[model samples]
Target chain A: MSTPRTPTIGLFGLGAFGRLILRHLGPHFPLTVHDPVHHDSAPPERAAACDIVILAVPVAAMAETCAAIAPHLRPGTLVVDVGSVKIEPARVMQQTLPAHVQIVGTHPLFGPQSARDGITGRNIAVCPVRGRAHLRIAAFLRRVLGLRVILTTPDAHDREAAVVQGLTHLIARVLVEMEPLPGRMTTASYARLMEAIDMVRGDPPGVLAAIETANPHARPVRDRFFATAAAVARRFESGDAGGEDQRRRSRRALIG
Target chain B: MSTPRTPTIGLFGLGAFGRLILRHLGPHFPLTVHDPVHHDSAPPERAAACDIVILAVPVAAMAETCAAIAPHLRPGTLVVDVGSVKIEPARVMQQTLPAHVQIVGTHPLFGPQSARDGITGRNIAVCPVRGRAHLRIAAFLRRVLGLRVILTTPDAHDREAAVVQGLTHLIARVLVEMEPLPGRMTTASYARLMEAIDMVRGDPPGVLAAIETANPHARPVRDRFFATAAAVARRFESGDAGGEDQRRRSRRALIG
Candidate 1:
């Protein structure tokens, strides 16, 4: 069980997702926030004494930010991350944090618009580096914030994300490359694909680079994606039962 | 200008999209409807007489259906089709309909969901085969129903649909084959992609077949899609700089 006192939360980085957190959590908790870009506009002094420190910056900056904040954290304070990629950040936090400070790595499996209210019914993946802090935080997230908690290792999270994010975004990249900007009218299916493309288009360049470059295991998954696309093209070119056969084979492989 | 006195409408097939029209316009206009599966199940007899006849069946079944309803249409009645592929149905309507009757080919660029209260503010592609009757229907759709109307030849409509529907659905088919089913939890991008896959999964097979097989020009689009995917796979396998190089090359191609 967590200590009953209200946890003071120190939020670091104020990007899009970070801003969303501040908007939702500021009224409810004792919030302290830091952003290098907004150094002159720091939060109130009371918030700096927070018991929980959250790193909500790009994945590439996670290591340096974790190192800078380690000394400021008091004993028993929890350091958590909300990065997209997990394993590397978890390793960085483990190496930089003090022995007494508990490190909990989390990837909230949603974005700002996913829920109308503050984090209700959304999934949060927690990979504990070395503490009971995860359970404490998970309890609060479920009991108070109404989040669905998923527990997994940092390694497993990245491996799965390689296919989930890597392949889907790769497909979007392909569509943008192939088609001219659509005009006049569209079907429901095309409208949906455009929505997917729009979601990823505004992501910071580093976010896309990290997902594509960091995951060594994603090569095979991407290869398989291309292979399936090739088979579909072959079928379309032939216009025989072969296309339908290929479609059936691919559907069974994916759905099964 | 349309001939004065409300032009009676002849509705040939009573499928999902057909039934919706009857529900919306049956009270105002005299509607003559025929369907092999549910000929007796059409609305009451008072809604049977119509000046314009709409053929709402699959492209493969259009010829036989046109023959069956040829004797029933009144002189000067306007004939239209609501099929995905336009050329074949347009040719059949031109060949079989009475010389006095005007022929117009229509492809409502929306599904049954858009027709809930009648297809207001939606798009309908109009391909006039041989007549002035299409002008009146187009005017009605634009002025009364608030539809966005695009007038094009039958061949052009089929060509555009080949890339829009055929290639888009082909990409959906490939993605479904390539990726594993994401459990209940996923990144925002994957969640959006799954929404697209669901839409494609639920589409009618007749729509799918018409988009895939009816367009003769779709083969080259499918070929380019496969070639580009293959190139992406090869670049990823070669390492970071190779992938970066491929990205640069693609951008250069776009610029040129």
Candidate 2:
């Protein structure tokens, strides 16, 4: 009953993403932040005491971070995770947090790089795990932050992201590492591929690893992607005249 | 001594790309088109009679098409083949055409799909093979059609394009075939990937095959891409904690 009618927000982790949330949400809410990196940041206990706590840590650290704040979280406090992959984070918050504390998993599709211009009209996927706090936060995300909210289950988010982010980052990381020659002749599609690479490459290795590894569905999609890529490479290597028809047939199979 | 002050243009093939070129070039020059599929079209001999004849056939048909027109071509006529892959076409034109006929291999990097809005500011790779006519065509491409002309060798164009269009169509063909579930939650990078797919997938099967197969360099690039992708997949599949360090090391190797 002592929780404020307008939730006081506590933001955890001050990495680029955490700082991004702070930059945008700082002015709008009664906000305090906790990041071990910053001496001035409120302590871990202070984050637990807030009415709404946002975890913006790397996915690899989700469980430990959740455990750190669980004991101190008020009965009615809402814990929101801003991790890219949602399934494991949702499960961690469910298991580690006090039964009375509410949890919702969120993946803001745009990062500081993509949203450099602004966050208005951008998308944020909300996977409501426990309690009614998700409704409140989704409304806040929509009305206050001008985000288009897609309410999805944690599994659905990961499944789609397996292909979306999974394929995007997988292709991008390899392309960047290849140091592809600067083509004097580039097509519109090729230019767009480069743009996607630029957008995803700014993410840290841990973030990339988490998206690829932590999500269970990601592995299967990744396997299919590589297998198909291998098959295409083999078909090309064979240099069979009939391979064109075979490639088309395989392409049709994949399209389906 | 008369190669006509303004070379009359003859466009061969009436596929989407050929039609696109016609739409842009039709009004500016004395133009005629010959598509065997169309009853009212000018005959192949008529196409050779034009001072500047453009071959817009599929790469598979380039040699035969060249043979059909070579004997009829006026002595000073410039023969341009707008095939997606250049080396084979360049050689075919050089060997099959009359030595008196000029040859320039061009790959307009836009098609009806990419150029739906119009072709201004788009790129066109001009590989001058057997003539000074390329200079005239490049100037016309820059001055009249507003194309950014990149004058490169056929081998250089194919080499870079292996990674550019080869990687593009290869990935696109796979992604399109996968028919990924409609992602209600899409990111900026994901949207760009989809846009690139849409642009390239509209191209016909023959074009896709030619880009992937006819260009010899494409096979090596495709092999390297899939190999690197497979390595990444294996690293993730192993689920080794130290795999991250290993991945970065291999990444450095690839970058070199």
lDDT by residue for model 2 over B1-256, one digit each (tens)? 8675766998888878788878888888888888776768887788779998988777777777787787788898998989889998999999999989888999999889999898899999999888688898999999989999999999998998888899898998888767854566888988888999999887876787788889999888887887777777777677742346535532332200
Cα lDDT, all candidates: 0.69, 0.82
C-alpha displacement of A91 in model 1, angstroms?
3.8
TM-score of each: 0.76, 0.92
Deviation (Å) of A231 in candidate 2? 3.2
Measured against the true chain A, the candidates' chain A TM-scores are 0.83, 0.90
Best lDDT among the predictions, by candidate number: 2
**Cα displacement (Å) at residue B103, model 1:** 1.8
